[model samples]
Every structure is written in structure tokens, then in C-alpha cells.
Target chain A: MAKTRVPAIEGWFTTGDEPALVGSRGKETGSYFFPKSVAFSRNPAAPAEKLEEVALGRRGRIWSFTTNYYPPPEPYVAPDPFVPYTIVAVELPEEQMVVLGQLAEGADPAALKVGAEVELVLGTLYEDDEHEYEVWKWRPV
Target chain B: MTDVAILGVGMHPWGKWGRNFVDYGVAAAQAALADAGMEWRDIQFVSGADTIRNGYPGYVSGATFAQALGWQGAPVASSYAACASGATALNAARAQILAGLCDVALVVGADTTPKGFLAPTAGERRDDPDWLRFRLLGATNPAYFGLYARRRMELYGATPGDFARVKVKNARHGLTNPNARYRKEVTEDDVLGSPVVADPLHLLEICATSDGGAAVVIASTDFAKSRGTKAPARIAAISTVTPTYPNTVIEMPNFATDSSAGVKPPETTFRDSIAAKAYDEAGLGPDDLDVAEVYDLSTALELDWYENIGLCKAGEAEKLLNDGDTTLGGRIPVNTSGGLACFGEAVPAQALAQVCELTWQLRGEAGERQAEGAKVGLTINQGLFGHGSSVIVIR
Candidate 1:
């Protein structure tokens, strides 16, 4: 049997071959929300809809990028003997939302530029002896 | 417009003093009272900007400050809006006088931040956006600032040289500020030589977390007149606007922005909307102002505010900086108190400190950093979590 694959946060992205982020789409108005936009709609006039789950685009353009020089404060588990990592803000043309994710292994600020194309990929957040926590990461394409 | 007179303003010099926040608050409160030539007993109401990172006293700052100053049975309220905490406290005090609930109100905001990127209060709850941003994406404050900086360079042709100039200019002004945390002059070389905290922004380009306090005493115009406090600067407007819905920009503490597909976005950005509301309330335009104090959390963010505050047209901030338009003795000197770049961010106290600088300038008392003939001045800052603040003061 395959080992248990867990996400750091639930209902945010998928684990399938297609590998896409999970978001919410309003039934009344065609709007997308990442991390589930259940409560309210941006349109004040249109009543909020019963939100439905939708898959976000797999490829997007980099809106901006930066490197985290210092170790981030906790709840963020870093690799021991910490090394700096780059974060990318990607704008999905289909969803019209900018989502942030850590850059893939060996890809960082020095290699990335604004408007660069990127594809979503699964990366390890961190792991204990029992389980590996899977999180979405961005890779240069 | 409901007018509130700021009869006094004072600050506890910003630095890493390693003292309890209560001491800073009390000292600043006493200084403000003395500046107004009033007593603590005269303060009918006290509103405090809260400090969440600290212990019990931070949450109940109004009562804590009142108790520290020897309580005089004054009504108290506390506000928390991240960095806008100070401005929110000022707005609360102004509201009391304008509502006829109090003749005079004292506002105090103080903080002693730990050195590092400001993190959320300790907890494990995944529901907190502030914590989630840090935990999941590793989004430190500088990351967001870096994102904005990179975008600015791409869109507006702003250069690292432009960013370095802002630090140099602010440091020069900070040399004149007794209360500023870092007062030494820094050249562009100094900025370029600093280590990179975020891409396109160096260590010297960013403000640090500091320990400081600031206070203001506001009274109704009638009360000031009765007390013979002549020629005082009057706060014509205080704007604490929330972001309009469909906020498309990706700001701190949020993993994603509102998708534009749901609704047509507003014409103005959330930051620009803050100044528009203040300008409307004060019946003044940007051109009417003599000086401005903007939140310069990062050097690039300062240039961004130049457009947001209507100092120049969009994508034209670089020109303004290069032309010496935002420096002292230029057209509309910005950050005349050296801004967060020099003072370092004391969180709750930072916004109030901006007003203190403006107050001194309006009084022609800002000895070295004074904007010549400063008749009208504005202070603006956007705290994390959608808190926007702007206050207009005129002599």
C-alpha cells in the first residue's frame, strides 16, 4: 500500500496527475476564490452563491518574486541547517488571482524574473518519521 | 467639518530601550500634557492604541496608561489596527471631542517590539491569516515589500538607484530629528553596500522594529479658545477607511487577492482611497499641502506612496525623487521627520509620531527638518489587515 500522503492544509489543492489548486466559484456570478470563498462575493448587488469547488490553472505567469534571507517565524517548519528560499507570486490568467508559493528546489530569486512562466508542482513542506506533508510549489517552466 | 484642535504633541525617543511599554506611554502622556500646559486631571477621556505583542497592559493600554499616570476617573478606549493603531487612537480621541462627549482627550500609543519581522501573536490556530501567511508561504513582511518593489521596477522603470536615494534623503532629514532612532547620514553607497534582506531592497532600505512611544492631546476648538491656547494646529480631518470590496491587489496577511471576474474593481486602489477620503473631509487637495509624512516601511514603498498620496501622477514617482521633489527644500518635502526609515517602526507609536512631526512643523518648531512656511500637512499610513489611516492638520 502507498504511504499516506497528507497536505499541510486541506481543501487548498489537489494530489492528482493533473495537479491543480482547489478554489471556489460563485454560482450566481462567475468569480473565483482560492482557499474557498464561501461566505461572501465581491459583487455587492448579487447575493452570495452556494460556492462550488473549482480547479485553478496549472500554469501561470510570475507577477513578482523574492528571496527570504532570514528564517521565518514559527509554525513554519524549516529544513535543519536552514538555507534561504525564494517565494513567487503567480498570477493565473484564468482565475485572475495572484497566489503565493515557495519556489521549487534549486530555483530561487536569482533565476526568476517578473512575467516568467511557471507551472504548479508538488513539494515537501516538511516531514516527521511517520508522514510527509505535501504542499504546492512553483517551478520555472 | 468637525474640527479638533491638537494643542500638544510629544514623543518618547524611539530606540531599543528595553523598558516596559507603560513607562514609554506615561512619559509621552506627561510630555503632551506639559506641551499643552495642562494637567493629567484635565484629560476627560483617554484613548490608547493597543500593543498585542506585549502582555496584559498592551491589550488594555488606555486603562494601563491612565493607571500609570495616576487615574483621574477618565473614560478609556483601546484600538488595534496593526500599524495604524496610533492613528486609530487619534481618531477615537478626535471623535470624542467632536461628539461633545469630552472637552479634551488624550491619545497615547506605545510599543517595544522584539527585533525581527513582526510575527503574529503566539498560537497554533490555522485560521489566523497573519499566522498562516508566515507558516505556509513563509511570507515575511519584507517579502511583500519585495514583491511591490519588483513590480514597481517592471511597471514604472524605477531603479535601485532611486530606492537608495530615498534612504539617503531620509537619513539626512533624520539627522535633524532628536527622537529618531537612527540619525546618521547614509550615502547611496552605504545603501548599496548593505546586505539584501529582500530582492531589490537592502537592509538599509527597510525600517526596523523599534521601541518607542508618542502621544497627542486633542481638545475642542472652544476648549482651546477658553484655555487661551492660541494659534494651535487644528486637525481638520481624520480618515480611517477600510478597503472597498473587490480589492484586487495582493496585500500582506492574505494568500490571494479578490478575482476581478466577480465584480468590476473600484477606480482607485485601497491606498489611494485613504487619501481621497481625507482630502474630501478637509476640502483640500494634494497641491494645497505644504508637507507630507508617509509610511516608509521600505524605501520603495515610500515612492509608491508618492502616487497613492497624489503627490504625482502614476508611474512618475521616480522622476519626483530624482528631481529632489520629495527631499527637504524641494516641492512638498516628504518624511520631514525622516519617516520609518530613520525612526524605525515602533508599531503603535509610529503613526502618532508622524503627527508629532507634523505638529512641530506646523508650529514652526521642527528646527532642522522644517518645511519652509508649512501651513498645511498630511500624514498617511496603511497598517496590515486592511487598516488605512490619513490625518490632515493645518495651522
Candidate 2:
């Protein structure tokens, strides 16, 4: 039997034709938070209210990016004989916030630059016998 | 309220020695005690910077160090705030002095870090943003530095050569300081030739991690007066401010910045607010600073701090460096102790090391790299987790 698919960290993204990242919108103050504010509102001016979960915009421009030369320590699952990968900070227009995610596989330093348009896609981080963990990655559009 | 006077300052020279942190803390504490012309028993209070990597004893470093020093039963407090742990320790001691709880308090910070990149503790806790940045994005600390360096290049036209120059300048100062980890001077070619850790930042331009210890003896002004010292370097002001809402800039250990949809960001940036608060309390401005020791985690970050500390206008830090205004014998020398570029960062001990430099400069004790006629000095450091601190010292 094939492994089950699950969000690497739940409540961050979903699977669809054009899956979008998840966030929360403050009904009182129009504030938006990624990973959806579950504890409390960060805004000082806004009173406490139930935040509505919303699917974030699919597209954004790369604000900045860098390729890591070394593998990050565990808790992070890197492929055997680890290959270096790039990370991009993407700025969503509607949210007016920069979200950081890994650039898609095969992406390198020469390809990405500031202000380049990027879109999100769900990718596998690592897989076990029972489940294939997934995370959001950025691809040059 | 009465003022707090730093009766003495001591540091076990920063290095990568494999000795235990407790020994370093004790050595620095003994040195400070001797310098203050007092015994350990005379200290009425003790405050220490907490090192998280160590076990539970590390969490209560104050009592740990106190017991190690033969336990006179002094009130103890331990504080932890990433790199600003030392400054937090200093403030804890200062509050005790100002409140008349202790006539004299001893502050100490020490750390023994690993060889390479400071990684998050081994865990599977997903809620921590620090761990998520690494596990999810593979964004190392230098990755953020690279982003900032690239942004500076695009926005301010800063070149790789300009970044290299900062290393050259600091390494030169490092040669004059006996305690620095890297004493060999580096040139612009050295910085450029170094392997790229992340996009715009080279390995040479980023600071390393090391083991070190620093301690200071602080007392009430009345106590200092009774000790027959008419003048001692005073901690005029300390700013321990948090970031304002709508934190636009993505800081270290954070996956993303706050969304700016509902509330507008504050005009005073996180770094700016720290310096402003210190200045307001000290009744002084940037013009009054004769010397400054800033956290230079990377060469580009140093330039950002140049503007953040009000040494220059927005986007004018490169010009300040080009004009020789920030070097020794200039308008105001920064990082006179060679900064983290040479000393490397020792976490809890780093901020206290900055204060030690300012204390030496204020007292005319800084030997070869001392800024001339330095009467007032300031030290600024920003740690992870929204902890920013600035300490102003005056003679």
C-alpha cells in the first residue's frame, strides 16, 4: 500500500489544484497572521476576537533569498548525501507580508533574485513507511 | 534614585579553550573581586547570565557561581535573553543597587559554544519558530545575514568590496587586542576570497563562536564614595526594549515577519527604539558618544547598526566608514575591541565583553586600541527573541 500524505506541520498548507498557505484574519482589526494566531492577537490596538481562517494568496514576489551551504541540524530531515538548497522570502500582495519557504528542487543560486515572481507548491520533505511528510516550497514563476 | 557605579570589570580572555564554563566564571569573578579591592564575602548580591545549553544548574547560574565562590549567602538572580544575557544580568544587579537591596552586587556571564553554526537544541517541538526556520526552511543564521547583505547592496549600492573593508578594519583592531580569537589581520582580498556561506556574506565577514567569560562588580554610589573612589564608570542608561507591533524586518530565528495589514509599523524601528530609549534616559544623544562597541555578527550588520545607533543618517553608514569617521582617532570609533568579527560571539558572555571594552575606554585602561580622550562610551547588542539592549557608560 502507498504511504498516506499529511502536512509536515499541520495547519500550514493544504493539497489542491493550486494549494494555498493558511492564515488567520482578525475580524475586528483586519490583521492577518500566518500559522494562524491560535493563542492571542499580536496587535495591541485590536481587542480579542475570533480570527477567521483564510487561504492566503497563491502568488508573491521574492523579497530576498539565499542558498544554505551546510545541512541544518536534526528535527530537520535532509536527504542522504545532502544537497544544498535555496530558501526564499516571498512577499504576498494581499497579506502585505513576507513568507519564507524552500525553493523548489533543482533550484540554485544563479536562478533566483530579488523581485522575481514565485508561487507555492506542496512538496515532500521526507517519507516514512506509513506517511509522506509534505511542506510548502517556492518555485520561480 | 541613587546611581550605580561599576567598581570593577574583569574578563577571562576569550578563546576556544576546552575548559569548563564554571572555571571561566570563577576566574573572571575572582579577578573582578581583586580589582574592586574587595573579597567575595563583601558582595551582598550576585546576578548571572544563564546559558541554556548547560543543564539545570546553568538556569540558576547566579546561585551556582555564588556557591562556587564559597557561598556567603548573597541574594542571587539569573537572567537569560540570548546574546543579551549579560546586559540582562547587569540590569538585575543595577535594580538591586538602586532599590537599596544590596550595597554591592557582582555580575557574571560565561559561555562555551560549539565549533560551527549555533543550532537549535535537539528536539521535535514544532511550535518553536527558531526550530521551524531550520527544520522547515533550512534557513541557517547566515541565510538571514545573506538576505540582509543583498538587500543593502540593492538599496544602498553597497558592494562586496565595501563589506570586505569592514573586516579589514576590524581585523586590524583585533591584532591590537590580546583577547581576540583571530589576531591575524585580514585584507579586502581575504574577505572576498573566502568561501561564500550565504549569497553576499563570505565566511570571513561573519563572526564565529567561542568560549569566554566576563564579570563586573557594581555598587551603590554611596558605597563607591565610601571606598575612596571619587570617579568610577557609571552605567548611565540601559535600554531593554522589545520590538513594536508590525515587525516588518525578518529577524534571526523567525520564519516570517508580522503581516502589516491592520496596523502600520512604528516609525521607530526595533533597533532605533533601543538606542533612543538609552539616549532619552541618559539625557544625551549620539553626538555625546565618544566610543561605541556594537555587535558585528556580520560586516553588513555592523553597517546597519551604524545607522541604527544614530552615528549616521539613514543609508549613510557606508559614507561614514568611507570618511574614516568610525575608525580609531575619528569622530567616534565603533567596536574598538575588534567586535565579534575578531572576538567571536560567546553568547551570554558577548554583551558583557562589550561593556568591559567601554569600561576600559572610559577609565583610560584600553591599551593600544584606546580611543583618545574618550570620556563617554556606549555598547549596543540585539539578541534573538525580541531582546535588544543598549548600555551607556560615562566617567
Candidate 3:
């Protein structure tokens, strides 16, 4: 039986066929935030503006990328016999912000380059007996 | 701004001694006091940098160090600014002296870090950006360093070999630094051959965490003169500014850069503005600096700092390195006391350690690592969450 898919962290991103990161936009300034800033406006110039929930751009160009050779310390859950993964910083043209995400599984680090286009996708972050933990990942296009 | 004299600077050396943090702090404080030719009771104020790894004592480090040195009831202040903690503490003491609240102050920072990647506080807090980055993306400090290094490669044609050369130069400089943790000379090949911890950055290219402490004694110029000590190194400025709105560059422990979609990005990037503020207050520019001690968190980061601190233009750091302009005997020698490349990072202690190195150089007491006739010096570093650290010292 296939395990139930659950977001590794809830409300940060949607888990679906065409997933998009959940973010917030300042009502007054139009600035964007990932993982949604619910409390206040992060923009110093537009402080006190209300933030509205919005979906960030699903696609962006790679600003830079790196591959982590060693497993990071917990609360990072590593797979048994941990596999190395590439992390990418993607610049969203609409948001004008660079957001970091793990490159989707099986994407070759060598195949990636600065300015390469990538889209958001839900990937298995880890798994348990009854559930598959999913998190937002970047897939090179 | 009025200048605060650096009466003396001292360090307990950088190494993994595995001792209590207090031991290192006391030793460094004693050394600084002795170097200043003053008694412990003479200090009118104490400023200490906090270490998160240790418990309550580390939190109230100012009183901890004071009590360890037999408290004289001096007013105490403790600051925590991640890696910029030392500079924060130093600034606190400088403020008191400049405000005439005290004639003399002791500033100290020490840490005993764990082995391996510095982890976030043990918890499952989704709100903390530091924890979220590690839990969600598994991005370590070196990972950020790797990203910047790769960006350099793509934009300015920086090579792995160029990064290795930075380690090679720093290792050679560390050979003459008694306080340096890694004093052995290294070659470019040795650095390049080290195991890769992060792409485009080798294990040798990254700084390790170590147990260390550093301290400085600062006083008003009038106080220095009263003590019959003339011409001491004067702190011309200390810049502890935060990032302006729309900090476009991605910083550590953060999953995203601030969106510039709303406000126009600042003319100066966050890192560039760190030292710019210091230069503005000091009435000096990069050309005025005879020597510098910048945080080389990673070899490639040092190259980035060359441009960040205005030593050279962006994309021209590699050329500056190739020209030997930043080496020990060159124009505007940088990291002359080996920097974090050799000292490793004691977080709270590292920034003050930079000031200690500059004070030694300005006093003409630095032995083999001395930058000759170095009358002006600058130190710059950035801490997590927008803590900018920069200090300018002149003799």
C-alpha cells in the first residue's frame, strides 16, 4: 500500500500535481514573503501594512546552487545511508526575491547552471511506516 | 565621534582546548588587564559577548567574567549578536567611555563550541528561521558559503584554484601567528585536495569552530594620558548597522532574501554598507587602510570581502589576489593575523580577536605577522540576522 503523503511542514507549500509555495504579499507595498509572514510587514518602508496570503511564482531561474556532501545535523531527518542532494537558490522574477529549496531527486548537479529555469514540485522529504513526508523542491526545466 | 583608546588587547589563543568557557574568559581578561598595566579593580565597566552553547553563566557573561575575576561592582553589559557578538560588546564599552559614564572598560568574549556543524538550539520550532532552514532544506553554514562561491564562479570566473590560493596564503601567514589555531603552512594543492564538504568549497577552505577567548581594554584618551601611556591605538569608529530595507542578498540561516518588488533596493548591499559606515565615521576610505583583518569564514568569502570592504571592485578580487596585493608584504595587507582561516570561529570571540590583531599591528608589537608601518587598520564581519560588525583603528 502507498503511504499517505503529508506536508513536512504545513501551510508552507501546497502538495499537489502543480504545487506552489504559500506566501504572503504586503497589501500596501506589494512585497512578498515565503512561509507567510502573518504577524507584520517585513518591509521597513511599509511597516504596519496588512499581509494577505498569496501563492508565490511556481517557476524561477537559478541564482546559484550547491551540493551538500555531508548530512546536516538534526532536526534534519536524513535517510538511512544518506544520499547527497543539491540545494538551489532560485530568483523569482515576480517576487524579486531569491528563495532556497532542495533540488528535486535525481536531478544531476552537473546538469544545473546559474540562470537555469526551475519549477516547484512536491518531493518526499522522508518516510515512516504509515506516511510519506513531503516538502517543496526545485526541479530543473 | 570622539576616539576611544585601546589601552591593551589580549587573547587566550584559538584552539579546541575543550575547557570551560569561563577558564578561557578569565585568562584572556587577566592578560588584557596585565597588558594595560592596570588592576582588575580599575575597570569601571565590563562588557561581555554571550555564548549560546553554555547555560546561564554564558548568558550573563559580563557578570560571569567579573565574578571570576573577583567582582569590583563594575557595571556590566552582555551582548549577543551571533558571530558579531564581540564587536557588539566592544561597541557597548566604547559607548560608555565616549558618554563619560566610565573612563575605563573591559570588553571580553569567549566560547567553547561543539565538534562538527554548529547546530541550532534543540527544538522543533517552525518559526525560527535557523531551525527551519536546517529541518526543511538541510542547508548548513558551509552550504551558504558554497552558494556564494559558485555565484562568484558564474559571474566573475572565480575558480576552485583561486579559493585554494586564499587558504594557501592564509596558512602561510598563520605560521607566524602564535595565537592562531592552525599554524602549519599549507599549499594550494593541499587545500584543493581536501575532502569536499560543499560544492566549490573544500573542507580546508572552511573555518572550523574552536574554543577561544579575546579581550580588549579601552579608555578615554584623557584616561590613557593620565596613565602615562601616550599614542595608544585609537578606535576611530565602530559600525553596528543593520541591513536596509530590501536586503536582496541571501544571508545565512534564512530561506529567502527580502523581496525588492516593493521598495527599491538600497544603493549599497548589506555587506558593503557594513564597512562604509565605519569609513564614513572615521573620515577614511579603503585607501587609508594600511592593513586589515576580515572574517574569512570560508576562503571564497574572503575574496568576496575584498570587494565588500572596497579593497577592489566586484569581479576584480581574483585579479587582486593574483597580483599579490592582499598578501603579507603587499599594498593593504589583509588577514595578516591569519583571520578565521587559521583561528577558526569562536563566534563571540572572533570579532574582538580581529581588533586584537589590529591593535598589535598598530602598536608595532606583532612579531613576524606584522604589517610594517601599519598605522591604520579595519576589521569587518557579518553575523546572522543582519548584525553588521566593522571597526576602524588608527595610531
Q: Highest TM-score: which candidate?
A: 3
Residue-level lDDT for B18 in candidate 3 = 97
Please list the Cα RMSD from the true structure of every candidate, rounded to 1 decimal place: 1.5, 1.6, 0.8
Q: Model 3, clash count?
A: 0
DockQ, candidate 1, comes to 0.77
**A1-141, model 2: which lDDT tens digit per residue?**
999988888788878889889888888878788878876887788757668889989899988887777666776778888877777889998888888888887666687778889999988787888999889998898
Give the local distance difference test score of model 1. 0.90
Docking tier of model 2: it is: medium
In the range B116-159, model 1's lDDT, one tens digit per residue, is 88887788978898888888888999999989999999998889
* Candidate 1 CAPRI-style tier: medium
lDDT at B366, model 1: 95
**DockQ score for model 2, please?**
0.74
Question: Candidate 1: lDDT of B327?
Answer: 91
Chain A of model 2, TM-score against the native? Answer: 0.91
Error of 3 at B261 (Å): 0.9
C-alpha lDDT of all candidate models, in order: 0.90, 0.87, 0.93
Chain B structural similarity (TM-score) per candidate? 0.99, 0.98, 0.99
Model 2 Cα lDDT, one tens digit per residue, B93-151: 99989988889999999887877888887768788888888778878888888888888
